[model samples]
Target chain A: MPDGFDQFVTDRLDRLLRYATAMTCDRYLAQDIVQEALLRAQRRWGRIGAMDAPYLYVQRMVTNEYLSWWRRRASRDVASPATTIAALTPPVGDPAVHHAERDAMRARIAQLPRKQRAALVLRYYEDRSDAEIAEVLKCTAGTVRSHISRALKTLRADNRVMEVL
Target chain B: MTNDEMLIREAIGEEAGQAVDPGTVLAALHGGRKPRRSRGLAVAIAGVAVTAGIAGVMIPLTASRGDEAGPAAANAATGAQGEQTILVLGLDKLVDEGQRPDSIMLLRAGADGSFRALSVPRDSRIDPESKLNMAYLKAGGGDKGAQATAAEVEKLTGVRAQHYVTVAMTDFPELSTAVGGVEVCLKKAVNDQLSGANLPAGKQTVSGEQALAFLRQRRGLPNGDLDRIARHQAFLRGLAARLATLEPAKLTALVDTVKRTVHTDAALDVLGLARRLTSQSGLTAATIPTDGSVDTPSAGQALAVDPVKVRKFTTEFFGNGPAPAGGGAPNGTDTRTPCVN
Candidate 1:
């Protein structure tokens, strides 16, 4: 590995894949987008890996790749089965959140606008702040706020999370 | 965190284990693409035409060309100079197909790193008898074609240029693909089969054959060739973005892609110009300021451009004052990026 990139990839690849999966709502497309981002990342990894936030940078690239793919897919208007949320098995302790209900929530989340979904994924899934999300999305913090607000509006409309939002 | 938020996190994290094989992804990076074959060059006309086009965007690998340019001349070109100009002509040429000069541009760069380019329409009046687009065909192509075209451009804008380059569209695709495709943002989707451009709306990276079509299609565009000039500016800016990070090895291949049409002048070799504008700054593009049109006794209806207005455009684009009316954004680049469509 060049400059300990092997370790860096090991540290970040899984996290990147999860974020990508959430963004694309498809495991296969997520893998493809992550691979595409990583391929491009390798070209400049020598310069970027030494930066203060190499993983964050690569994660941003993954987001861009997913957005690009999203636009491409949208224009083509092709329907894919995996775009639907997959059913999840409930973990041992969490009986209040039924797996089927979680699946319904995930599907509803996927229906939000791309920016909204990305904001939710970055904010909740990656545990990033509005400023950090802005940095990653290359948008103003206000725009990030709007994306989150609009996204949460949809979530709140769902009877399951009406009070939470 | 709220319980609902915690549940959402847990829901999304279910797929955290999903991943592509890193080894396969890494292996594909270098395995598929090998260096291209056959070297190419674009002959630069020297002595009279200014060699300028937002060289800010199309500049590639001056640092890599250091060995080729030696030390002295390379340094001089890269060092800021006082008052320079060049004529840049972009053409669409395909195998066994007729060639057309679709983009006619003039650029002026003062020593301060400020630059402006005027895109003259292909149908602009050169003489009462013929359109500016026919200059190349009248000269039977190649160097003669570029020279004849440059002469007409000189007449139209009244700017004497000693350096010129006529770049073919054939080479642009390979170059765009080489740089991993250039991102294009269109307010609306373009679908013109005649020029082979069938693109969806928003931002996308156009590569190779598709890019040729993207650069070629002028028909069915909102304002015909006029809008295509904006596309040219945008594509060039994308190309510029790609060039900023071009690898040293790919730079050689890129230079090998274009067939040169002019040769007598070494002062404005493509390599030197490419190196000088590697910085890609203070660039703007405009259509030659034309105030509507009139019918000539011999030439039918023609665009009416006052030389005075053009000079004013020149002044404002270089930051002397406010820009004159009639022109698109300072172009061949994305002023709206980082948060792309």
Candidate 2:
């Protein structure tokens, strides 16, 4: 690719990393997803990078890679040696603290089904509209709404969140 | 967004600022690009085509011992991404007579959608005197027939099949009718009771029962199974040529017909074949070339197959290496050189 493309990736790397990390919860998995998307983006840099929303297009590829998990299941099955589940697990501190409820809720969000978790993350974290999320997830906007509705309902049912509501 | 949504989003983004090495991601994509391709293609003969088409030349002669037409069921197969070698069979069931594996053809479909078809005559001896078709009968019926036929093909050609699709003979009529019928020509009229074929001389469009009869009859024709193989080649060429001219809707129906009538072993189904099809290079049908005739005391009359000839043909038409300098191999459609004696 052109030198400008390298500079572009260098500049946007942290943002893409943030999106991947938030979607996957695991740091290693997020890096892998971002890497696959970038490699694909590099191949189409001239066309895609020129588009108004190149970052969104690559983010969609990352989402697709996660959904089409069967293709890379064999190699990725191994847990990353460095990023222990305990280290990345939410609710890292002791239970009797002020942040207890918030941590517990984050854990529940992580436990949600993949699509629902993706929908919820794209909506609340990245501030994507339902139509934007649908484009990324390759589904109807109605389906995306249903996913968010279900995820939020599950979260709301949690006694701690119920108290807050 | 609700309060819970805001809180949840805030908690999820706690560790989003961590920097990951860009080198790591790019390396994974480059390092693991290949080695995922699974070799071998499963093949089965779709026995019939009832849907008529615009035009087709070879009428596959098949006899079914059955009460009514039934769906054969296409299945899936596993193959490499770039090119796949599939075994396409034409199967028939005679009432109380058992299943007859009438035609065997190996189709090599490239990543580019270029395909080359090689037909193996039923009379081609698997052993010194035994015919290739007997493999199905020897193994009994159902999946055993598919296995036995696949084994014979592997032994004959160097290609090892990992998947297959077997289709019923009756399904051809529906396919034939859908294409406005396949056109078949003959120099003289023919009458064959065994195959239920009675046709006049000259060119005619055949469909339904008539199409099946036209494809199934090779008894009176002195060449026997060899003539039938030619008819099979002609049938494929006719189908390919006709499909090239058909409306997309007609082609889709034909694909559906193949999907319904054929049974495959792996996930590589007819729809998969249809979707990947592009830049159709050319279609050539050829038989496993034999050097001379041989009559073995144990196996009766079998073609004296030249192994050297088979190797040359495969290398020319199917090898991954550069295509041979000259035109690959002699085609079955070329009536100039008699493919079968």
Candidate 3:
């Protein structure tokens, strides 16, 4: 491994893990994703380290891994139960009712089409612009806009989401 | 525009901004790399050599992992909050090796939880008769280009850009690949010999290298640079949507990619702000409407932008709503006034 490979791993490992978690919506799966990506990155550490942005190479690896998983499953759903809950549930669960409400919201968001849901999360949660979101989602700005519009319409129409909000 | 939209943005922002330990990630990476030298190798004949080899590699991995985690972890935990503006500058004319800004876009997020995106064309002939990209190069490069470009955009759009994210041509590939690939829609089959990018009309996901080609293709495009800009916008929107689905590992990879390829004044907190914005719902996108024309200036012939239409578009996009006033819904409180049940 090159001298900076270890440092690169150390420096970026956490963010990569978080990103993987978000993408997979499964913590364990996220771990596996990161591990695999890191392993691949390590294997090509010398060549990668010489590149302008080796992390980009690792990122590509991780996303490709996730996409492969999606292709294998033939289902586009990426969110897990925990992720759905996490997205909806507030941190402090003092009241069971609130928890339930959060869960409902999560379920509603989960019910959205995969691409639409992804667009909502990226545009709103990640605060990425249409361009950035488009880059990440592998689509055009017009498509991104359509997704957002459709996602928002669905979210707004969801009785549960409307009630919760 | 609506209450639901605001609440959704607040909720998503809060959730996405939550902190996690970068140390664990570093440790995992190091642990994965640890050499597995069998203790009883060759019936103990190679024990000493194997043990030495393992220790030599393990020690540094552990040491480096240890030092790298703390600061990054701290940074992640202390992300930014509230309304902010981020400038994303695209250097259009410059190729991979060149360093400068060719185009600029301003993104503003208000406390009311609304967003506005504005773009300035690269070829817009300005006072000095130089293309918009020259402003960045003349101001220095990289961070300097961002600052200079931001200042110029403020003059053009009448909105102050708070911070900027500058990406080189190479950064685009790294970035596009980092989040997987971006999907682009082609209206017609594109075979641009100059940029070496060929594609049939339709929807397709492109990798980093391909993305670079897509963004660079100019000739054969109906609107020329204008069409390219639209294509760039489409690519970005797709990329953002793709990123939204990223698992933690991929998100971390994105952060790493940003650290490597992007130059920005945005603090870790601001990136956090970006994360929150992405996690939210109801974000709207619109282009700064413009009618392109040719103009002759002291510098030479250049693309002329209709300043009046640009100004009107800017005001219309960003001026409708009141400036966002505060951070997301009060922490730990789901203030959504339930509408359904």
lDDT of 3 at A16: 71
Query: Residues B1-341, candidate 3, lDDT per residue (tens digit)?
Result: 67556656554443333324556556656676422111111111100111111111111122222223323333332333566666766443221134445446666666543444455666665554676666776775555666777777776666777766554332345656766776666767777777767877777888755767776676776666666655555554555445545554555444332322233452423324432343332233344554456565654556665556566667766764422222111111121111100
**lDDT tens string, model 2, B1-341?**
66776777776676354435656554554564411110000111223221111111111101000001112111112222566666665665421135666667677766655666666666676777587778877776455666788788877777765555554443455667887766666667878887777778776666666766666666787666666665665555566555555554444444333422344553443334433443243456666675445777775777655555665766666753433432223343334222222
lDDT at B80, model 3: 39
Q: Where does model 2 sit among the CAPRI classes?
A: incorrect
Highest-scoring model, DockQ: 2
Q: Provide the lDDT at A77 for model 3.
A: 28
Worst 10 residues of 2 chain A by lDDT: A74-83
Tell me how each candidate scores on DockQ against the true complex.
Answer: 0.08, 0.10, 0.06
Q: Which parts of model 1 are misplaced by more than 4 Å?
A: A1-165, B1-60, B63-79, B92-100, B113-115, B136-148, B259-275, B280-282, B291-302, B318-323, B328-341
| Candidate lDDT values, in order | 0.57, 0.56, 0.52
Instruction: Give me the runs in candidate 3 sitting further than 4 Å from their true place.
Output: A1-165, B1-82, B92-98, B112-115, B142-144, B266-268, B271-275, B281-284, B320-341
| Error of model 3, residue B271, in angstroms | 5.0
Which scores greater on DockQ, model 1 or model 2?
A: 2
Superposed model 2: Cα runs more than 4 Å off: A1-165, B1-80, B94-97, B187-204, B252-257, B269-272, B279-281, B291-301, B319-341
TM-score of 1: 0.49
Report the lDDT tens digits of candidate 2 across residue range A71-126.
21211111111111111222334763336555556556655777888898788778
